[model samples]
Target: MNESSVKPSEQLSRTLAAGSPLIYVVTWEEERLEQMLARASQELFGDDRPVWQWTAALGFTSGPGADRQLLDPVEALSFVVSESVDAICLMKDLPALFESRPALVRALRDVYDHLSVRPGSMVVSHPSINIPPGLSKEVYLLELPLPDADELRGMLGSLNSGFGEEQRVSDEWLDRVSYATQGLSSNETRDLFHQLVSEKIVDVDAALAEINLAKAQLLMKENCLEVITKKYDIDKIGGLSKLKSWVISRQKLFTKEAQAARIDVPAGILMMGVSGCGKSLAAKTIPSVWGLPLIRLDMNKIMSGGWGAPEVAWERAIRAAENAAPVVLWIDEIENSFGFLNDSATSGNMTIFSSFLTWMQEKPANVFVAATANRIEILPPEMIRKGRFDQLFFVDLPEAPARIDILRIHILGQGGDPEEFDLNHLAKVMNGWTAAEIEQMVRAARIDAFTDGREITYDDLIHNIYRIVPLSKTMSEQLNALRIWSHNRATKAH
Candidate 1:
């Protein structure tokens, strides 16, 4: 089994047996971690060992003179050293003290040495990993992941048991609720459940919408990942038959049959090429096609340092995406994030880029990455290499047939009949126009017709086509270079 799949208690047991004096658990779910630590202490010590917890607000919690409130950082470390032995010490606020208190850092190192000889262990639980350089080697960092489906189902079951028989939902409801709440922490999930129950919102669809809204609010708090509630039907998208076919073929990868056959889930696909050619549209449509929730990773937010350091932000975003697995992660304009792939790149950029590449290559199978890039040239070769992405699809300007499909879709979308207009002639005339440009032309013509109190006519479309200059005509040289570069490198998405 993968390390990520390992249970927290099991991971703790293994880490403890490795003789790691200090363990740093990175998570927001302190209650959940404490419960796991309690179980781990029992298994390790062959009895119920007192798990002492220390906080800045409430000093040393459960020991002799525990009520005395040993509030000082130095005093707390001294307590762990002199008093707490053959037990687990959980320091809730110690990570924050490292930067301001060098003496506390030195004391922790001494405690590390002392714990190596003793059976007791010190565990630091914080939401973020911020170890001082001096104690980095001595600290074992363990990130506690969010609740998975099984755990969520168990929570749902527990909650359901409290409801009246008439109010209780089916097992199917439990499964759906569990799947919907994948990315939430145990506490968050429990709170959401209570809110839903109080509101009497038991219907699966209604509950899912509430869950998604809650999740969106929680995940986007950092501005890294946004839950994409807007879904596009794959069939409504014009052209990209090959890409659509590829998607159809992989739809079964998530099924039990595929698992039974030992088939590997697809890593993801990289859609790169011309602008306004449905790359973003395709990214949005994929989750709908596969029947999964979609979340977009804002590379801009990750690198902006508005939330925190870019590297830390990226890790948190990736973790959030993984926690919400069996879902699609859309990274639009991916090249912007790793544009500093050249030698002049800063160490921070290099670290973020390397981390991105590593995650893409070895990401959890359930998380399908749909990355779109307009300028593939700026992206590193390693990023676009074969194994990093399942396939590289070049989405160029729509061909005549595809243009007709796009025109029809947009015309129908604008409440215009395609048969009334000369679609073949229109498609022929808009030879180099992209799907977006075509849609825009259709929209402009509809607006003109609506203003004139008449139905949208072919002449109106033709008139707007002349008024708007397509990217193909203006950026001819760039388009040619992109076509030539992708001709041999990527499979055609048309």
Candidate 2:
């Protein structure tokens, strides 16, 4: 069955209607979920089944028999079991309290066991909860998703006053605004809207800037993904014309029009080649040209075991990256992270690998992956399969034309006139050097001229080229092996 046929609210109603006694809903937005749950309750439990809530801060504030304060976890569970009425009861933030009182955990399970005879439903809500093994079987886990575009638009539309064009915003403009605020909570969107409104003037451009900042902060708070604040312009990288052309052609994949046409978004590309051959630079800068946020994901950091196990952190990172949609997830030195995927002995590594592979396969289209690898053998066969990623490109050593382009780009970038230097001679001599190596040559050559207190000369560039040993010479065997592997398996990047 297609999952998109049913909305989240409808699914919640069905779960409760099917007599799932103890539902554990996960979300950070308490108020929003509570209202949604109330709607769900009325549909399943009828108008007379009073929906109530209890919390540590405000105990028994929203229900009947509101005589006493049940601030303790033990008392809350006792209240749920003791109250013999057809009323839905929700307990907020119960895990920590239950952690301290093991008796409450057992009591909760017992409550779940007998809740079927009571003719009511009990729900436990929290941002994230660790379900004890005792009650794991008794609880139905449901994650409350973030508000979608339609909900966000309704909230923003109410606050919008004379901001859009002709006193009415275009649908395209509204959609972009909606997409920009995709990852935010209802409360967060409300706060941002009010903040924008307090200036007493409305501007779509100004509002979008604030929304992007808020959305980025929402992703960063997860601690798994880091936002690339600085621009890595795709046009700055020289050479690799084939790869650049492929990337440029697919720029419209992220647009609303593409969505309307049901165009499949580009999954991603694996850039494998010599260490300094613009592979990493291409991965970093492609998002800029695509007009998407670039987020660097640290695989090791997620697996470091401080927050939780590697699998747990890995899932969070994937979800967090998806939440920041229209994003480029740059995984650098990917072989180091997934080398163990082929081993039967390394179970932990295999688990992380499996989780990542599933996410990449099933993830939302808005999250584009740009993974870079230097060692091809270490990558698992499953990782290179067509469905896992859109394509894999080999970033080979720069040819003469590519080298000249690299030389002139870096030379101009460093404020030296490419016209003043013998770029042809420099490019010819820089045979077998990668783009990174050529860039370093340009940099080093400038320093030589800087020490002499004058502009860099063509001879200075030639002089610097002799002092450096390119990666091709140092790792010739490895480079050759990579080239052989990519011959029939991957497309040529340059």
**Candidate 1 lDDT score at position 385:** 89
> Cα RMSD for candidate 2?
3.8
Off by over 4 Å in 2: 1-5, 18-20, 41-50, 65-68, 73-87, 102-120, 132-138, 161-170, 193-216, 219-224, 302-309, 340-347
lDDT of 2 at 232: 79
Top lDDT hit: 1
Q: How far is candidate 1 from the true structure (C-alpha RMSD, Å)?
A: 4.1
**Compared with the true structure, what per-residue lDDT tens digits does model 2 show for residues 261-303?**
8899988889987888888889988876766677888877777
Tens-digit lDDT track of model 1 for 31-116: 98888888878888898756888888888777553777799978888877887467888889888888887898898898999999
Candidate 1 backbone overlaps, count: 0
Model 2 TM-score relative to the real fold = 0.85
Task: Judging by TM-score against the true structure, name the best candidate.
Answer: 2
Error of 1 at 350 (Å): 6.2
Model 1's alpha-carbon lDDT is 0.84
In candidate 2 the C-alpha lDDT for residue 80 amounts to 72
